[model samples]
Target chain A: MTAFDPARFTRLDQYGHGGRLGIRYHAKAEDWVELALPYAADQVGDPSTGVLASGPIVTLMDMATSMAVWTRRGVFAPHATLDLRVDYCRPATPGETVIGRGECYRLARAVAFVRGIAYHRDPADPIAHVAGTFMLMDAPAKQARA
Target chain B: MTPPPYAALLGIAIEAEGDGPPVLLLPFGEPVLGRPGFVHGGAIAGLLEMAAIAALDQALQAEGGGRIKPITVTVDYMRGGRERPTRGVGTVTRLGTRIANVEAVAWQDDRARPIAAARLNYLIERP
Candidate 1:
């Protein structure tokens, strides 16, 4: 069975919210995936400071975490976010691309546990921290689907 | 209060009235869809956060305005958001001198039954 390919999955994102938000794949590991959100004027949460909105950051983490589950399982399947929590350490610097990395730590029969962080330049200095769980819709299978 | 650009991106509109928290609306569209038949979880979270911010802003405006900075937010999704317009409203539970706690709920057809809910904490810098 072939492992889930985040690059291929993102390439088919023509009509999804992630595509509209300009999210792109950056890197991937066995249990984690990193995505990038370029700074845009339209995504400004505060017009005065040009700070990117928490919403878009949440979106970036959500997609990254979602993909992390697939990467961990070595297959793509249907799932839904059950709950998510985000803590903002600071605001993103204006005009810098926000990189989000999500890691799937535990995969159960019915749910997947994930945590993520969003940072501008260094992963050590994250702007936001995220923890969430996704409800797995399909049962585990031996063969991976491409 | 002027709606920010992110509001426009999510198709969020404020339905404000006489000196109270505004109701935020998110219409179903391609920009909000996640898995074809359902609205994205992030979009729903965004709506709830906007609602919480609106409520806090209204409360702060009544007491001589302040800058609101989000500290943390936790959202729980109870149901899958279908292809329809969703509504969200936030209520301030406690507004302290430095910190504020707010809760928001989002629903599609029935306000009594929420599809998602969120709890948010904010740091307020008084003006």
Candidate 2:
């Protein structure tokens, strides 16, 4: 049996970049997860417009997808990002909370496929679209929820 | 390279520059740490991105300057960023009136052995 709990990472007490950006667990379900990146003045990329940096958005998507992998397997297996692609649809509106929702579409013996979108205020018009893959670095016994 | 606020948040700083774009250095610390003794992939990508922007900006300056907007970025993580200072550099491959292509690489120890690298495409708006 694997010692994996979805709730453990849901309300993550993350440090480092995630902590610096104030990333919070927003929502989650089987094989999918959503994360929140709060708007902050320091997070602004364009000082003139107060818009967020794309790099932070990329960071958010990365974490969202990484967790989605664990959620998909129902176990927290060590994994590393193999590659990630981010397509900016448009700049995020200033002073709006960006929500990133990532879904694990496929899982192979050693890889996990993920896709996600980030939106502010309205989900209809996303700020960015992301596609990525992760490689499992460790073997973990997957535990199924009863 | 002058560090931006995002770069500050990631604890990245300008290491050196000579005729070309400046090299960025990310100190290994709590702010950049990921998965215990390993650097977060996101942090590595962030460093590469700042480097890319710095290169793009320098290239545009010589051409009377313009606004650079990101279109897309593809980052390939080759190896884990270890618990050590990481260095990154962005090289502009092509600069056009309306578009620019940039490549960036991050290495922990040897420059030849990269931990991660990124390719960025930007849309340019001339003033």
Model 1 chain A, poorest ten-residue lDDT window? A137-146
Instruction: Put down candidate 2 lDDT per residue, A70-107, tens digits, no spaces.
Output: 77787876888999999999999888899998888998
Candidate 2: misplaced stretches above 4 Å? A1-5, A139-146
Cα error, candidate 2, residue B103 (Å):
0.5
Candidate 1, A27-89: lDDT as tens digits: 887667899999989988888899988888988999999989988888989998889999999
What TM-score against the true fold does each predicted structure earn?
0.95, 0.92
lDDT of each: 0.89, 0.84
Best-performing candidate as measured by DockQ: 1
Which ranges of candidate 1 are over 4 A from the true structure?
A140-146
- Model 2 C-alpha lDDT per residue in residues B27-117, reported as the tens digit of each score: 9987777777798788898899999998998999888988878899999999999889999999999999899999999998899999999
Among these predictions, the greatest lDDT belongs to 1
lDDT of 1 at A49: 91
